[model samples]
Target: MPCDACATAAGDPTGAEFLTTKSRLLRLLAPLLAAALVAACSTRAPLPAAPPAATPAPAPAPTGPLTGQPAPNKSRWVPVAWSELPGFDADALHEAWNAWLRSCERPAPAFVPLCGDVRRLSIASGEEQRAWMVERLQPYRVESLEGTSDGLLTGYFEPFLEAARQPGNGFDVPLYRPPADLTTRRPWYTRQQIDTLPEARAQLAGRAIAWVRDPVAALVLHIQGSGRLAVREADGSTRLVRVAFAGTNDQPYKSVGRWLLDQGLVRDATWPGISAWTQANPQRVQEMLWANPRYVFFREEPLDALDAAFGPRGAQGVPLTPGRSIAVDRLSIPYGTPVWLASSGPTAQLSRLVLAQDTGSAIVGAVRADYFTGWGEQAGDVAGRLKQNLRLWALWPK
Candidate 1:
């Protein structure tokens, strides 16, 4: 994800800082102007004063323990009462504490002082946590400059699959580490090139970290960006390891599901639907896979018992909490900001607090977000089908 300086340098224009400086200048000049006006009244002969300029009424200060702040470019924060948060009272606040604690690991400067309170409240009751939140933070309804509050929400999950230490016993498809010349090459190779070109294959010759049985499973792992692989070792034992996102091929990510839909091959574009289509049209599998040009490489990490309990580290550099972590556009919401998310759709009805912990190339917009469902088949099922309307409220420091 881009840093604040990078985002600024990337040419996002916002006048909030300039306006703030102008306001300070006006305040400083007010006293001098007033004194000059008094001197003119005494020194000059009585002259008719010009009609006073009509002053625009000041916007009402927000009430009910709510305050406002300027959001990032293309967005604004509307201060809202805690009562306005849907289902705020009913949500299981403790379930979100784990995510909140993770945010504390790399807390934003404004939130640094609150991390101690957040950690102490981990063991506190839900009601207690809620009370502390009400006292310390202000909920701002996140909206675009046009005041559109509704947006889209999707879901993603970690995948767990079987693998072999080497390419054998039906584990023919290989998952690779980044090629040695990855940094030097602007885009090493396209997915189609990597599969068909001898030179591309030579580049990845010895880069395989593990081999999986099915190409479809490998595709899922690539799309998800990371996965837990249960690798069969040489000694007839299995070891679980995490294959994390190392880098991409630098090509654009085109959805194979979208390609299938456009070709009239499948009505459902979810993973299950795509799998069914592939099974039925085995001959065209390569064609379907090549619909996307991007390829992701991975690096293996030991998944110890303690590490297994949490999801992979997000862009925020902290382990994600399933069901409570969300990937957001950094330009819309900075990482570590607590967000109140509400969405109702076929797959799930959710009204809960989530953290802006991670980011995806696809997750871009003032209100858009991608919810993180956990790992395994059930999570995948939900993630595959979760496309719904969303509303968000950022819980910011007062």
Candidate 2:
């Protein structure tokens, strides 16, 4: 719901005006990023308590037939020829190169030696870039243990919300930092427990980072793991800051979207549909939120025009590249690995090279992935709508 500027320019990194107004306008139009937030939030629901951790299988080497080290989970990898990669020639390699460079910020051991070559290729043409990949990297098609080549691919993004320094004028819901005892506890309070239990509330009393108008907005921030806050300062001026994932309460995540679907409360479990339900059932907002037991804590950081164009750092410890970064199950595909992705849905017919830079709780399957759709409404729209069939080829150092 951000102004046309926020919606139109979020995907374009060069939009100086977009970056300037992004934080301020984003809070006003929560719709801009709401969809991605929903996707990410819903996906973060804890997996049914995982059984005891199994001994990880050794990972395969950079070569060989579909045989080698096993991925941590049930994911499998099969070596594939570059010719098998769909639309390999059509993608903008430079765009993916940006993500690759970001990944180099904390390059994997195999990738560390190739950093110089990667830097030189920055100025190379698309064809040249492709040649570099073909010459230096091996492509391995990822699969599920069931031998299926396909799996689910969803999307998520960094959200921006409006807030007040103090709780008043409808801004009553609090965004809190982690409690002093968060790390010491096995599992902390549930969402419902935190809302109604006096002890839980007291522990978080002085930890409020900011206050928002809607409890749902606070919930969105919790699920997405990070977001930007447009804060109304005491002097009546607006200041922008980013809240990052500091820790979680160690409670299992539950999918509220699935909960609503199971309860037959909503026909479509998308953010818009969920929002409508929340509005119509204001009395039951707490019930809807309590459906998920997990809670996230945050730490705030500064946000400026330069930083506004990028997203929060991913598991790879690098700023995410919009349109060219993805969150993969780290155990299946190591972080910093480059990947060839082919997924077509209502939002886009994507055949692109992306970096495995992040991870999500829901992105568990070997072939599963969560696309980082950038920030703002436009990114959210694509991410929210993008639950598509996926094929992946990991591009590793030869």
* Full-model lDDT for every candidate: 0.73, 0.71
Q: What digit string (tens of lDDT, one per residue) describes model 2 on residues 1-398?
A: 10111111111111111112244465653544454344334222211221221332224344553323334465677776777777776676787787888888899887888889899999999978877777777778888888888877777766666789999998898989999989787799988899899999999989999998777766665766777778888898777788888888888767667788889998867777777787788898788889878888888988765566567888778887777888887888888889988877665667778899888766677888777776644555556666777889887776
Best by lDDT: 1
Q: Model 1: per-residue lDDT, tens digit, 1-398?
A: 21110111111111111111123433533443344223222211211222221332223336443224345775677887777777777777887888899899898777888999999999999879988988888788999889999998877767767778888888899999999898999877999999999999999999999998777677767777887777788887667688888888888777777788899998876555776777789999999888878888988998865566677888999987778888888888888999998888776778888999988777778998877776655556566667778999988887
RMSD in order of candidates: 20.4, 10.0
Error of 2 at 247 (Å): 0.9
- Residue pairs clashing in model 2 are 1-31, 1-32, 32-377, 46-253, 59-69, 60-69
